[model samples]
Target: MSIKTQKIFEAEFLLEDMREIIRKTSPHSAFSKDDKIQFNEKLKKLSEIVEELRTNKYTELKIKYITNGIELRTREEDFINIHPIQAAGRLTLEARKALISYGDGYSTCDWCRKPFRLDKIHRPPIDEFHSELAEFVGMDQARVVPGARRGFQAVVSSLIEKGDSVLLSAISHYTEFLAVEDSGGTVKEIPLNEKNIVTADATVQKIEDVKKNTKKLPKLIMLDHFDYMFGNEHDVYGIAKVANEYDIPFLYNGAYTVGIMPVDGKKIGADFVVGSGHKSMASVAPSGVLATTDEWASKVFRTTQMVGDITGRKFGIKEVEMLGCTLMGGTLISMMASFPKVVERTKHWDDEVKKSNQFLDEFLAVEGSKVISEYPRKHTLTKVNTTESFDKIAKTHKRRGFFLSDELRKRGIVGEFAGSTRTWKLNTYGRTWDQIKYLGHAFIDIAEKYDVPVKANKQGQYSGDV
Candidate 1:
């Protein structure tokens, strides 16, 4: 059977069984001892669903619901629901197992033993994994954090003081702003060019401007490899060079690049590197890695050496900023399980970009569709303006923006933001060639049905004339 067919079949088959299980597991349900035993037996019979969950057989599941007197079923694909294409870094099979096995409290602690350090030398596996993580990002030391934002918090808290200036891209993620603000530091945004790319020259100018205005150099420079809004790749290498010349510490925000693309912290001249496990490292939510060079590791990961003056007690084991250990449960294990696959996939990043651009070309084949992001797309996630074609229908149709979403849904496509017709974003990450082709065709078919003017390119790919 085809991929879509298989998924639909699986979803239909599991629906009733899962519903029954959920009913039995509901907290409101009152079960006698015998009833509990019966439910346990029933759960054992649902070995398939359990196995699927354990193995990460599918990244998403479709559910049927009766709404407004109409029966409807829809697929819930991650990341794509809000954007066009999914990013390459979703959870892996091993990650799913790790989540289940280590999700219980103290599981990680049990394995690592005394001190409970994620990178302690006594625990060879955890220590080795820590070493591997550092090596993966070309840094001297690494630590798993609650998320990328925590990594930012750690670095900012370590470096920034009240009234200090920090340089950031105008399009930087909100978490960066929060991190800086929490550190009592002032932010200076590096303006983007017409292309929305943060150029090295612009960063240098901003640094000089900040120094002139504040009478002091900014304490840190943080920039994203690919901004979330546009998924546009910036000149990080160039920016890093500028930071080096100014003797400013640079933090490379690799939340979108670390697991999906190759990055070298040293090569980029980054004093610190931060990455998101859920967004790009094939792990569950709220997990990330913070890596730094040897020069800064002592400061960023400094151990707690404070003593309780009255009690005469000392706590010297935990890192000050980390607050003991971060990513203690399934999150860390899932990241560990996904590390090898993440490493392997980064090698084929070029092919992934090629596929992204190919799909974009076909998508733009529809008349009046224009890509809002940079051309010759370097990233899979793209912002698009569909004002000319889809928006025309949205203007007249009673359903408005929802007409396009309904059409795509019927064609087994999901992920486009609901009620959005003029401008929207989508990610085409981790999709197979066949799926990509079908997606392009789905859009073209919808436009043709609505009488939208669509002309095929010379290559005849997605020529709405079909």
Candidate 2:
């Protein structure tokens, strides 16, 4: 059972990715064949060890297809990765340890009983975890979806009818648009304010305008607590109020807020809450949660009344929106494993923001660099303008925009877009203070090396003025 395994979970995942990379190349090429053979050899060795463990394992083993960041690892152990989306999603040691036990197919369903639904599974305490997750975000009920996008799909498909209108932020994620489209609904954008932030006033005007033109209220109102583009907090509480006033249900998109920071769905007057486990919670890819208030839980999570035409059977307990159970694979298990740590991390969010602000404070010391995100950093994700700073160097450098990525990689900092210089985003979530400090110094050091002017630095202070 509990075999003392090495940290091979990540190493083996990387090996699988390596195989995939070679598969996409010229298969007939000798080089490709050679690389594939080498990968297969190592994989076989890993498989042998896994087989030994599995024969004796009643509990833990070192075998699982962990599809987290397989395509691009950036070696978090060796490099400081500020990749905007992945900074928080990196799995905890416990989550990896969990993979040893539940990484097999449908591992979480071994004790499925009664209604035979995922949320009803009580052996691993999954049913209770669902309840805890609901309360974690201040909602009455919760279900894990494949991703935050799927969470949007569940809400839209549950409510939206053909030709119905939905309200969304002008800078809404593309997946939101797709979710509405799948439900045969048209979405009208609520334009951002001068500060590039979505406001309740704008949402109100958009709803009224849609109502006047279409002669009916929109089916749903969806807004991000923090938009992905600018990582700027929107007027979500205000929008919730507007939605209530307009007699419309509001879905709070918490892809950026939920796991990293405390999200009170009831307090925000949210009819539904959607969060990304792979984006904020320290979990595997394609995992998230959709929570709803008691008022909307019945409708959104409505069970199927479909009967088997040939078998003459009914599946009344199965949720139509979820198609019974949403996440039943390793993705769900990983989310379960990371839940406790994720809950505790939310409390330290203020400290994370402080680290973010501190890093930005020094980053701005590079004369031309600017922070495009909201000042003083409410959250760890941010958009920075390096056009006037790094872009200047990129224009004259031989490697062009790649010069930045290349240099940062040399300094053990990674996750920036190669050949990108103008405007880009990064996250400082879950990084240690020392790592954050080194990140700041790395940028400042690079700037000074490039002959960029430096401003006088007052360290450890929030310098929002760039």
TM-score of each: 0.85, 0.84
Q: Write the per-residue lDDT of candidate 1 for residues 1-466, one digit (tens) a residue.
A: 2334345445444454545655676786676677666666656645655566567675355434444655343344421232442354467878876775677775677756666676773432777888899999999999999889999999999999999999999999999999999999999999999999999999989998998999999999999999988989999999999999999999999998999889999999999999999888988778889999999999999998888889978775789999887876777788899999999999988887888888877788888999999989998888999998899999999999999988887776667888999999888777777667677777888988989877776775453322
Model 2 sits at a Cα RMSD from the real structure of 9.1
Q: What is the lDDT of residue 107 in candidate 1?
A: 65
Residue lDDT tens for model 2, 1-466: 0133333444455465555656567565345567777667767766665665567543344443334644433267657889899988999878887875677778888899889899999988899989999999999999998899999999999899999999999999999999999999998999988888998889889988998999999989999999899899999999999999989999999999888999999999999999999998888888999999888888889998878889989975999988888887678878888889999999998999999998898888888898998897888889999999999999999999999999898887888877899999998999888888888888878887899987877554323211
What would the TM-score be for candidate 2 when compared with the true structure?
0.84
Give the alpha-carbon lDDT of every model. 0.83, 0.86
Off by over 4 Å in 1: 1-86, 121-124, 461-466
* Cα-based lDDT at residue 285, candidate 1: 77
